[model samples]
Target: MDNLTHGLLGLAIGALRRPDGQRAPAPGQGPRLDGPGLRWTSPTDRAVLFGCVLAAELPDLDGFLPAADPVLQALQTHRGLTHALVFAPVWALCATGIARLIYRRARSRPVFSYSLASVLFAHLLTDLWTGWGTRILLPISDQRYSLDWAAVIDPFFTLPLLAGALWALARKRSWRRSLLVGLTIAAAYMGFRVGSREILVRRVERAYPAATRVEVFPALLSALSWRYAAILPEGYSLGRVSIFGPVEPVRTQDLPAELPERAADNPTVAEALVWARVPHVSIQEREGGVLEVRVADLRYNMGGEPTLQFVVLVGPQGETLEARLERGGTIGEVYRRWKDDRRGALPAEGGAG
Candidate 1:
């Protein structure tokens, strides 16, 4: 999920708790007027809200590392150890120390540390929804986990949380109530997305009964549309299904995705394979006997937009010469880039993969 959603959820968590470390009473249990509209103007409330903001955004600090290589940065730092479960408490303690320095009163308030820690956990929880995923088991395992239920930047997921957090901030008396409502709505929305995803998965399964595996991703900003891919013995089939539109097959190359033993050892290829769910690997011959190898995820390419791909230059005998990241953009732009990369390597010129 995006940082904005993380921040808003942190604020909601902070606002849901009263300054006295007690949560607002459930509906009908407290004074009817004291519901969400009750404003508690306590210094602790301010401190807690500030602390939440700091904690939620803290996990993203790893993204600031001065790593030069995008792949190295992605594999080593971004959503790496810092976003792991074991590191959340350490992060919380560091955040608490910083908060204590900024807000002297925070040193005496245990609730500040607790709230900050909770918000940090919230940050990790929310990241599960993104396709980029997070490495929660860091030192023990480098496995990345994702729900694939929502896009990293879905307004359907963010808007309710944002609105609720804003409402909590706007109506002092109703802060707690508004926060609860926001969290509830967000949770329910996710449940809906999950249910919808399951249905879509079933639909795809029915459509491609021979598929050995199927994966579905929520379309950008939409719960009604999805991108799905299925692995078949021959190759893979990918397509899009839209509740509002028609379900159709995705454009894909008929090439096999299996990596030849010789090319599998390249770290660049390995990392690209790890990152892509439904990958397509292809070979091209360029001028001067150079071989161009590409490994890309089909899901991102299905939309006809710019998508990440690993392009490697190799010798005729499969010795890797150079490898770098490239992207496929809209049809025209991708055509130009592909054309440029294959200059003087066409089949008429005796170039063969």
Candidate 2:
């Protein structure tokens, strides 16, 4: 999500339902730091900041999942099981519990369950339109859905109104006026998103000429433009250029999935896991096996680099998406430059005791 989006989300939440505004103290002033795991704070302001940042970044927590054997990582950060609806409530509840305990010690009012839920909902909704899909329902079942009505980033969708939101809060405008301004902006975006999707659908149908059964979603984070991906009888492919907006739909292609020479857990597997895109969507064999991982990245070249494709994954039998991980120590000593960098990768299995 954009920083501006995060900031606006935070401010809107604070103004709309903060005790500092008019709402009754729901509970202790609770934890305000961002990110998952335990968090705590003493002051209302800090708590609000916590609420805001958490609301902003909560959708991306699944990016932290470890890769399975024969790793399949994608550059798409938010397209994973972590974005699933089922996982969200559990994560939120756990975080809320931590806040409740911490606020108990500080004797501050814990944030209302309402506020927490509000933020979570906002996070999910914000990501719902982008090209990268989010699986809101996971574990109950692997059901992935999206509107695909916006680009990876959008200027028309958020800029002017988000700017107004900041101005309203900074100048201390009445809550109603500020909220109205924000809502108007949001409403306009929704309208544009619809129109954009319609245009892409028409163009896509023309491209295929005889295509049947199409699915299109605007890439999340994109402003008004959309990224259209569809499944054909042969295979799946992204649509052509936006023709109106800044987006360029990726053309579909058929590629071969080259399995890792050895589909066993190790550092190479970890490398692939980071690229898997989904934090929770990985192979976990009870007695050593493989998984069908689907990876999508525009940069992949099948006959050339073996990566940079729209969908890439591996399985016990064959390839779902053409995917494989090549080793890299570090790039200019910027990342993965040390042993500890691997700490964030999924824990390795089949290690020595």
Candidate 3:
């Protein structure tokens, strides 16, 4: 999910924490201080809001970490250690310490710490709801988990949360009620998406009885449209299905289930395979005995072409010449390096087995 949506959720959490009878003042107007030594007792003080927003977005801070490979950086680092459940308390403690220093008399340490930890947990849970995988249990296991209920960037999910946050920030009373309504709507929306995906999955399964496995992913922009991969004995079929339009797949393509040793053995390719859920390999013979191997995850496909892909250029002697990650491009742009006459061709059955 995007940072803006995360921040809005943080704002909503902060609003919920606001103490009774405490009215939120206009922007730039500080919270009303009470008690001896001018202690800031407001639970919805600046420190609390800062802590909430920070905790909400802190998991994504792993993106700053450096890595040798772009694919590893994106797949392993961005949502890796920081997003783990075990690290949530550690992150909360660190955030609380910072908030305490910034606002010395904001509130009780336990209150702030608990609120921060809750927000952090919410952030992780929200990430899990999206199609993009999240490594919730890092030290225990590196396996990425996802519900595939919503797209990473969904306005339908974010708008309600945003409206609640804005209402809470702008209104002096009944803010929590508004936030609750917004959260309820968002939860119901996710339920609808989950139910719709299940219906689509069942329909695909019934349509392709021979399929051994059927996986459905939420498409961008709308929940009604989904991308599915049905694994069969010979190969896998990838397609798009519209829940409202028809129970069957609107667009479908069959792809062979083969991974070449030369491509898979490459260090970069190996790292990407770890993260790819439904991989599609395209090997094209280019000029001067060069091989352009493109490995893409069907889960990230848009308009029939994959946006998240890894490309490896191999020399005639099977030596890796170039290895890089490609993101967000049309089919032509992604395969522009290959000649127009060339097409993706798999090697002999056992040649690259």
Which one is best on lDDT? Answer: 3
Q: Give the whole-model CA lDDT for all candidates, comma-separated.
A: 0.68, 0.46, 0.69
Candidate 2 lDDT by residue in tens digits, 155-266: 6656755766767557543433565477567667678667866877777776666555455554323454344444556544544335474434343444224435543333
What is the per-residue lDDT of model 1 for residues 39-137, given as tens digits with 9 covering 90 to 100? 344446566777777788888899888654565466556888889888887767665667667667554355456555655546887887677788888
lDDT of 3: 0.69
Off by over 4 Å in 2: 2-7, 18-50, 69-81, 94-110, 173-176, 206-209, 215-353
Deviating ranges (above 4 Å) for candidate 3: 18-45, 108-120, 250-257, 285-291, 314-321, 330-353
Candidate 2 C-alpha RMSD relative to the actual structure: 12.3
Give candidate 3's TM-score.
0.79
Which lDDT value does model 2 have at 343? 28
lDDT of 3 by residue, 1-353 (tens): 88887877775676555452345546555543321223234533667667777778777878889976666677777888888888888777776777777878766565466556545645887888777778988889979999888878899988998888778557535556677678778778888988898898898898789999888898767657787888777666666677875544333445633656766576666767766677677778789977777777778865445677788786766677877787855657645522211222222222111
Q: After superposition, how far is residue 48 of candidate 3 from its true place, in Å?
A: 2.8
